[model samples]
Target: MTAAKHIELMSVEDYLAREELALEKSEYLGGYVYAMAGARNAHNLVATRLLVELSKRLEGGPCSAWNSDTKVRVRTNGYTYLYYPDASVVCDPNPGADVYHDRPVLVAEVLSPSTRRSDEGEKRIIYSQLPSMKLYLLLEQDECRVTVYRRTAEAFDLEAYSGLDSVIPLPELGIELPLEPLYRGIENA
Candidate 1:
């Protein structure tokens, strides 16, 4: 009989410290870290488009848009997790000394086949747990569909939009993001 081997998990502090020297980005969940996959062309396009539009709208305001490189820390069920959304908007003036932001009013994720399940499932649930999150956008890479989850007093409300004329309204930020830019350079398959 073979003896079972025990694997030790990395602490959050060590994980964060190691991440600074890592060549590629990875996410921290509980005591384990998971490597993040690279984004596809369509995914990058959508993220960039949204980021640009949001940046334009948030210029000189209390809020600002952050690209995927900016880490977002989320706390849920007594566990701490760090993630990098496709794009995020943070309205808080004080972001703390850590490299990650704890309060993001908006978080966007460009859907990919490999990550679709986790994005729509675990990520969704964890993101909703954020007290400051007002809107969550799930952009489709294969199509022009954009799903918006607006937070309400009770729960997050769902809204879906498709087509170039449709616009996503973020009442919290007072910005209306048009959908045309998101699918601008996506080649039809």
Candidate 2:
């Protein structure tokens, strides 16, 4: 559960073979595996809602929606192998070996207390390096907040939103998300 426990020498295949039955979330470090904690009900609920809405909207588009079970491999030269995101959308349908993509057009992470900082920090940094990544999104499990990053020629621009009626326009996928369906069953709902 600490820095020392994370091993950095296991091959991607070896890591997968060892922890295939893991009940909780597990991250594949360069060569070792680390157990990931569970997300709260709100976190999982929102992730489900977002995926549902995204799937419905992206049905006929070229992009495909991937739930968390997919593992994302961020190209690390030789430093590290993969880093998983909660949800992702890819323009390509024929992603090889990896179901989770490093070339994703868009990636979404549902925030939990333990991972909010990582999703915003280390994970964000790792994702930014992907050439095909266009938008990186953070979904709030504690509130109705959503932060989006769009790739521009010079840099990735940031757009943050809250409450209902704030539309998330995913141009590549030709879809827009309104807050209504995303925050469907919270206490305030």
Candidate 3:
């Protein structure tokens, strides 16, 4: 008979402390930690562009744009999930800790082939659960395509934008992102 392998889990506090001193970033889900994969050039470019645009438009405002290094903490009935989104905007920053933000007004993920499933499926569902989250963006790195989820009274409304001329209107943040600049310098996008 084959023996079953044992898996150990780390507490949230331990994970946070270790993550601070770790060389590479990792995401925490419940009691398990998963290593994060490095993003490609196109993914990096798209994330940077979105952050830059958001920062420019939100200068001196209450909200601030954060890079992927910052983690978003999601608490459910039975579990806690910490994810590092490509870019996130927080209007009401959490004063308790600098490591993670619990309330984010907007979160964006640059889609890659490897992360497409999680980004669109699990991440999307969990991110929408945040009461403060008003918008979610899924940006395509290899193409000028964006999937926007805007929060409505009852539920989230889905919108799609494609082509360089298309503009993503984020009334929640009072900013509009032009697709041309977002996909700029991305070869074959």
Please name the candidate that would achieve the greatest lDDT relative to the true structure. 3
Residue-level lDDT tens digits of model 2 in 6-90? 5357787777776576667678766667778877889888898888888888898778888888877776667665666778888
Question: Pairing residues by index, what is the TM-score of model 3?
Answer: 0.94
Model 2 alpha-carbon drift over 4 Å, by segment? 1-8, 94-99
- What are the Cα lDDT values of the candidates? 0.88, 0.80, 0.92
Better of 1 and 3 by TM-score: 3
Clashing pairs in 2: 8-31, 9-31, 10-31
Q: Which ten residues in a row have the lowest lDDT in candidate 2?
A: 93-102
Alpha-carbon deviation at 49 in model 1, angstroms: 1.1
Local distance difference test, candidate 3: 0.92
lDDT for each residue of candidate 3 in 66-173, tens digit (9 for 90 to 100): 999899999987789999999999999988567999999999999998999999999999998899999999999999999999999999999999988899999898
TM-score of 1: 0.93
TM-score of each: 0.93, 0.88, 0.94
- How should the candidates be ordered by lDDT, best one leading? 3, 1, 2
Query: For residues 1-189, what per-residue lDDT tens digits would candidate 1 score against the true structure?
Result: 999998798888998999999999999987779999998887888888889999998898889999998888998898999998999999983445678888999999999988899888898999999999999999998788988899999999899998877888777998888888778757641
Q: What shift in Å separates residue 23 of candidate 1 from its native position after superposition?
A: 0.4
